[model samples]
Target: MLQIITEKFFPPGERYETLHRAILYTNYRVMRGEKIITPIGYLLPSTGLHSLATLTCEMLEKQEKYPDGPKLGVFVATTGDDLLNDFAAVISFFLNVTCTPDPDLTRRLLLAERPSLGIEAVPSRFIRRMFDKDVHARDGEAAALTAFIKQLIGLERETFVGAMRAIRQFVIGSHRLADDLNLAYTLFVTSIESLAQGFDGHVAEWSDYDPRKRKKIDGALKDASDEVAAGVRDAILSNEHVALARRFRDFAMAHVAPSFFRVEAAGAQGPISGPDLPIALQQAYSIRSSYVHLLRDVPRQLTISGFPEATEVDDRKTLSFAGLSRLSRHIIMQFIARGRIVEREAFDYRRELPGIVTVKLSPEYWVASTGGFDHKTAPVRLAAFLEQITAAVLQHQKDAKLTDLGPILTMVEHSVSGLRKPSQRLPMLTLYFLFHQFAGPEFSCKQWPALFEKHKADFDAPTVESFVAHLITGNRVEWTLEQLEELHKTYFKTRHTASVTKIGLLLEAALSLYVAEVNRLAGNNARARALVAFAVDSHPGHAALRTYEASLPAELAEINWTGILLPPRPSSEGPSADPVPAA
Candidate 1:
C-alpha cells in the first residue's frame, strides 16, 4: 500500500478519505493478494479534499485500462501509470471550471520502503514529470478522464505512440501545473512542441528546408561568403525545429478553432475573446523557454481569465492559463481527430521512405530509381537474384511462426499452356505461387524441377534453381546445388558472351548469399561467413550480391521450420490421400 512521506499532513476533513497514511486503499480492493485497510478513504483536507480523492479513486479503479496495468512491483494503488490515469480524471474535472483553482491541499502517496522492489515510488521520465506536476493541484481533476481516455484510445497508432507522451504532459499540467499558473499555461504550449517533435519529420525532397551548405555541397546552392555559410549550416541542420515557436503558433492557428478562445466557464468571460490566437499562443511558447531554462515564475492571478488584456496584440500580452488550455486542448483533439499526425513544419527526418522510382518511366532511367520492370521487359538473367531475396524472406517468416504455411505436396491442377499467353497474369501468378511450394520434403526433388522444366518459357530456369536452393537450405532437405555444380563445371571454360558468364556468376552468388543470411540468422556464423565469402568471391564485383552481403546482420530472424509452414486446413487435414495431385 502507498504511504504518505510528507512531514506535514493536512488535517482530516468532513468526507471519506483513504485509510491511514492516505493509502489508495479505496481504489484497490486487494493488492498483491493481501488485504489493504479501508475504502472510499482519503488522506483528506477541507470539504473538497475528501470528495476529489474519493470520487477520483472510485472512478479510476473501475476504468478499462486499470486491469491491463502491471501487477508486479506494484506497491499501493496500481502502477504509476494507473495512478496518473486516475489523477488525469482530476484534470478533466478542472476543465469544468476555468481559472487558477482556489488553493487546495493535495495529499501525497509514496511507495512503502520495500528493499526488494526495484522501481522507486515514481517511474520513467514521463511519469516522474507528471507526479511532480500533480503534487500541488487542488481541484478540477474530477470528470473528464473518460473523454481523455477516449481520445487516447482512438488515435491512429502509427503516430499515436508519439502523441501520447505529449498528451500525458498536457493532462498533468492542465490540472496540477495550474498551481503555478505560468507552468500550466506554458505547458499548454509545450505540449504542442511535443507533437511537433514527435511527428514533424523532414521532407528531404523540399530543397528549401535543406541547409545552404548541403545545397552548396550537392551543387544546388551558393552563398556570398563560403566561410559564413559553412560555419552555420551544421548548427542549423542540428536543431530540427528551426522556427519551432513560429511553426507551433502557425500550425495551431490553422487547426484549433477560434471559438475555443471565446469559451466561457461558469458564465465568466474568457480572456482574448476575439480570436487573436496567433499572438496569444506565440506569447505562451516564449514563456516556456524562460520558465524551463531560467527558473522564471509569473503571478498566477494574471491568468485567471485571459481576455481584453490578452487581446491587446502587443508582445507583452499574457495568455491566461484558462484560455491557453482551451486553445491547446482543441488543437490536440483536432490533431487526434485528424489521425495523430502533427500539423507542424519539419526538418531532417521523414515519416516514410521515398519511393525508389518516381512512377514515370524513362528509357535510360537510373536503376536506383528503377524506371520500371515488367515480366516482358525485365532481364531474364536477373530472375535468380530476385528469386533468392524473395525466398529468403518467405522462408525466414515460415520458420519463425511469424507466418504459417502448409507443406508442399502436389502438382497444381492447371494447364501450363494457359500460362503462355502474356495477357494471363492470373495464371502466371498461379505458376508463381507454385514455385517453392513444390520444394517441400516429400516432393523435394520431384515436382519443383519437373514443373519448371515443362514451363521454362513462362518462368526462367535460373529463378526455379534459386528457389530450389532455398528449399534445400530451409528444410535441410538433403540436397546440394546440383545446378551450381553443373554450372561450375561449364561456365567460363570457353566464354561465350560477357552477359552469359556474368549471369552464371550472379546466379551462383545469389544462392550463396541467400544461404549465408539464413545461416547467420541461425547463429551458424562460420557457415554464414563461408557462404558470404563464396558469394563475394563467386561474382567478385556484382553490385546486387555485395549489397546482400552487407545486409547479413540486418535480416530479421524467423522460426518454426514447423514442418507446417502454412496453417493447415480442415478439409486438407494432413497430406491428401496420395502425395500426388489429382491432376
Candidate 2:
C-alpha cells in the first residue's frame, strides 16, 4: 500500500527515494510482527495503518488542499511506532473534518494548520499544539518565520529539506560512538552551507529586481576592486560567491563573530593566528569531500595537536561539532531576519516607494538621466547634481586644506536618492551649498551662482525669481562697514539668510569695483573714490573680497570713501540717499 502511494504521488527524487526505502523497511518489520517504538509512544495496529494509508491517498489526490501532504505522509510512514499513535490521531481528525458537511469550517481548520504543516508537522497533537501556542505568542516573529518557510519552499525546497534532514541525523548521531562523529560534522556543515545559499538567493533577488540598488552595489563593487582580494572582488561584482561557504565565513566574521574571535596575532617571533570561520568551513568541507571520494588513509582522528606530548583529541571533535552547530543556528537566524526585513518592505508603502520609482525609471536612467521636466525627472537631476558636485569637491580637496566634506556629500546623496516629494529637492540643494561654502575655497563661492544661473529655467518661477530679486535689491541698498562685517560673519557660518543676503552683496560689490577700476584708469579720481566707497561700505568684511579692496589705489582708501551706494544711477533706480564723501 505504501509503495503504491509513493509511486503515485511522490516524484522521482532523493527525498522520494528515502521515502521508498523507509516504507520497504517498515513493511519488512510489520511482516515479521515486530513492534516499533519512537520517542513519543508505541506504534499503531494494522487497521490504523490501513486507515492512515487510505486517508493519505485521499489527501494526495487533493494535494492542492493539503500542500504539505506528501512530506507529512513520508514522515508518518517512516517514523517509529512510538510516534504512530499521535500521527494516526492527526490523520483521523483531518479525515473526519475534511469529510464533514461544513466545508467552510474544514477550510478554516486546514488554513490554520498550513503554517505548521511542512516544517513543524509531527505525529503528536500535543507537541504540535505547544509549538502552535508559542508561535501565536510571538506573532511578529511567526510571520517572519512563515515568510522564510514559504520562500524556502518556493525557491530552495531541495536544499532546505536537505538541511533539515541533516539536522535530524546529527541530533540522532550525537549520542552514539565516535564512529558517528564524522557523519554529524559533515551534516552540520552541509546544513550551514545550504542556509547560506538560501540567503544568497534572497539577496540576489533583491538586487536583481531593484535596479537603483543594483547600480549602487555595482558602483561599490567597482570601487572595491583595488581593496578586496580577487575572489572577493569577483564575488561582489558577479554575486557568484554568495552561495559558497566562503561567503558565509566572511559574513559571520563581519556580523556574527566578536572582535576577539576574528583574529589573534602572536608576538613578533610567532606566526600570526586567527580563528577564521571560512578556514574551518573549508577544512570541514574537505573532510566531507574525502569521505565522498573514498580517499585513502583518511584521518579518522578528529583532533589537532600542536605538540605530541599533549594527547587531548576527544574534546577537539566535540568542539568542532559544537562550533558547526552554533554556526548553523546563526546562519538560520540571519535568514529569518533577512526575510523579516524583506516582508516588511514588501507590504509597507513608505518603504517600497523608492524602489518602485527606481523600477519605473531604470530603463531611461540606467546609463544617465534622460527625461524632460516631470515628477520622475527630479531624482535624475538631483543625482546628476550630486555627482558633479562630489567630483568637483573631491578634486578641490586634493590641493586645498579644508574640513572633511565627505559626510555631508554622502548625506546629500542619500537624501536625493530617497526623495519622494518636490519640496525636498531645494532643502537638499541648500545643504549642498552650505557644505560647499565651508569646504571649498574662495573660488567655490562663485560656483553656486553660476549653476543657479545656468539652471534657472529648469527651476520653478518662484525659486528663480526670488534669487534674481535678491541680486537687484542688494545693488540698490546702502551699507556701513559694521553691517558688512555682520553679513560676513553670517555668510561664514553658511546660515541660509546670510547666504541669501551676502551672495547678492558680493555680486554687487564685484560690479562696483569693476566700475571704480575703469574710472580710476580714465583719470576720474573723484568718481573712482565714490564707487570705491560704495563697494567698501556694502561688502568690505569678506576675506576673499578684502584682497580686491586692498589692491585699490592707496589714495582712494585715504580719501575715506564710506556710506556710498553706486554713484546715484539715473532714472527711477537711482540711489535714495546722498553718497557719503571721503572723511
Candidate 3:
C-alpha cells in the first residue's frame, strides 16, 4: 500500500515540501470518504499482519539496498493516521518484542535506509529506546556527524563551512521521522545565533571560518523559507487569488526582502565625515555609535527607515560640537547616507544644550540647510514648531486635556524667530518633554527650582523671580485681580512688610505714568499727597497712603492744596473737597 501511494503521489527525489503536502492531501481525501485505496496490497499479505510492520520492513530493505530509492514509506505512514501508529508498533515489535539478536538485520536496517524513518520508527514503543544497546550500534556514525558540525561552528573558520554545517544538519535530521523538525526549525531560524555563539565561544576558531559564511546561512534560510512558502501557495492557489497573493507579497516583503542596508563602515572604508565635533558631543556620539552598531553583547536591531537619510560615509571630516548636537542620530544617519553633515555656526548659543541640539532632526532640508535664512514666513513656521513641541509635551501629560497651547506658545514663538530661529525642533520638544519631568501632577512649583536653573541663562533672574512671586501670590488669591489686591493688603498688614518690590515688578511697565508724575513734583509736600492719591487710585491695596505721606517731608505732604490740579483732602476742619478733580 505504501509503495502504491509513493508511486502514485510522489515522484523520484521530490523535495520534502512536496512529499509532505501530498501526504497531507491524501489524508484529507481519506477523511472526506474518498473510495480510493492503495494498489500495493500484497505486501501486507493478510489483514492479520500489522500494516506498519510490513511497510517498515520492506522500506528498510529497499532503502538499505538503494538509499536513493524513493521515500514512499513517509507518504504512506504519515498519510494514514492509523498507518503511522501501526508502523511504529510493528517496527518496535521487531526491535524489542520479537527479541531477536540478529546483528546483520539491525545493521542493515540502520545503515540501509535514511534516518528519517528510523526516527519515526522509535515513538511507537511507548518509550524511546533509540539510546539503548539496540540503537547504540549506530552511535559511532552519528557522533562523527556531530563532530563535523562542531568544527563547522568554530571561530577563525570560514563562514561558508558554518553555513554548510547547518544545512547538512537540517537535511540529515529532516530525513529522520523522529528527528524533531520543530527543534531543527528553531535552530535553523536562528542561524545567526549559532554563528554568534561560535564567535563568542571560539573566537580564534571562528576567525578561521570563511567571512562569507554568514551571508550563506542567511541565503539558505531565506531559500528554505521561500520554498516552504511556495508549497503553501501551491496548496492554496485555487482558494483565493487577490487575498492570497497579497498575503504572500506581504510575507515576502517582511521576511525575504532586506529593507535595511547593512554596510560595514570601519577602518578605511568608512562613511563620509564632517567637521570635528566638540569633546563633549564626541563622547555622546561615541555612545550613540556603540548603540547603533550593536557593539554590546546583547543583540539589538533598529530600523533606520524613520531616518532614511541617515548614514555618514567615510572620507570626510568628523562633525563639530554644534554639528554633532544639531545633527541627531536620525539626521546623522541621513547625513551618512547622503555623505554630508551640519555646520557648527548653525547652533544657537542660548538654546544649544546637547539634549536640545540632539533632538533637532528634520527632513526639511530647505529649513535645515538654509539655517532659516530664506523663508519669508519662517517666524510663523518657527512658531508652529514650538507649538508642536508644547503639544507633544502636553500629550505626555493628559488629565488636564490642554489640547491647545496656542496662547503660551505664541508668547515664546518670537523667541525663535529671525535671529532666534532654531535649526531643529527636537531640542524644543526635548525641553518641553522635560517640563513635565519634574512638574507635579498639577504642574506646580515643584518644577520651579529646576526650571530656574535651566532657563537662568536665557531669562532675567529678577524677572523670573518676580514672576514666581506673583504666581504664588496669585494662586493664593484665586487669580482674581480684586483678591490679589486684598491679599497684598492683608500680607503687608499681617507681616509688617512695607516693601512691595515683587508687586512693583509685576506692575513696573504699567505704572510708568504714575512714576513720571511723582518725579515731576519731587520735593513738593502737597504734590506728594497727590502722588499718594494716584497710587491709591491705581492700586486700591496701596492702603499704606498715610505711610507714604509720612515718608515724605511735612511740606511735600501738605503742598499747596488750593491751586494744584490735585483734589482736596477729606479735611477735618472744613467741608470735603469736590468729588471731581480740577480740569
Number of the predicted model whose lDDT against the real structure is largest: 1
If candidate 1 were superposed on the true structure by all CA atoms, what would the RMSD be? 18.1
Judged by whole-model lDDT over C-alpha atoms, candidate 3 comes out at 0.28
lDDT of 3 by residue, 1-583 (tens): 2222323222354333212111110000011211221221111111112111111111210111134544654321233333232322222322221111233433333333333432323321112232122232232432432333233222222332344343333222222223442332232223322333332232122223334753554455575677774564444433322222222222222222111223312221222232222232233334333443554311111111111122232422332211221222122122112221221112122231112244543312221223343233333333333333222321222221222222222322334333342223223322233333323344323333453355434322222122222232222112333333344344334322322212231132123223323334454334435545554454454334434534655444333211121223334423111111101
Q: How well does model 1 score by local distance difference test?
A: 0.41
Q: Across residues 1-583, which tens digit of lDDT does each residue of candidate 1 receive?
A: 1111110121332222222222231111112222211221222222233422222222222211223453663222233333334333333322322111222322222221221132222211112222232333323332233344444444444455445555666765655442345565567777777776555553323243446545655463254376665555554556554666666766776666645544433343435544455666667777788788887764444433323234332445556554565556667766766664332322211122122233633211221122242323222223332333333333332321111111211212243334445333322332234334532454343345565556544423333333434443353433235543344335434335332312344445545655555565667777766766676777776554455556645443432222212222345333222122211
Ranking by lDDT: 1, 2, 3
- Write the number of the candidate with greater lDDT, choosing between 1 and 2: 1
Model 2: per-residue Cα lDDT over 165-262, one tens digit each: 43333333332112334454565555555555544443433333345655666566675656564455446556443334455444544435342233
Instruction: Write down the TM-score for model 3.
Output: 0.16
TM-score of each: 0.35, 0.24, 0.16
Candidate 1 residue runs with Cα over 4 Å from true position: 1-53, 56-148, 174-182, 200-239, 261-270, 273-275, 296-316, 340-583
Q: lDDT of each structure?
A: 0.41, 0.35, 0.28
Report the number of the highest-TM-score candidate: 1
**Number of clashes in every candidate structure?**
26, 2, 58
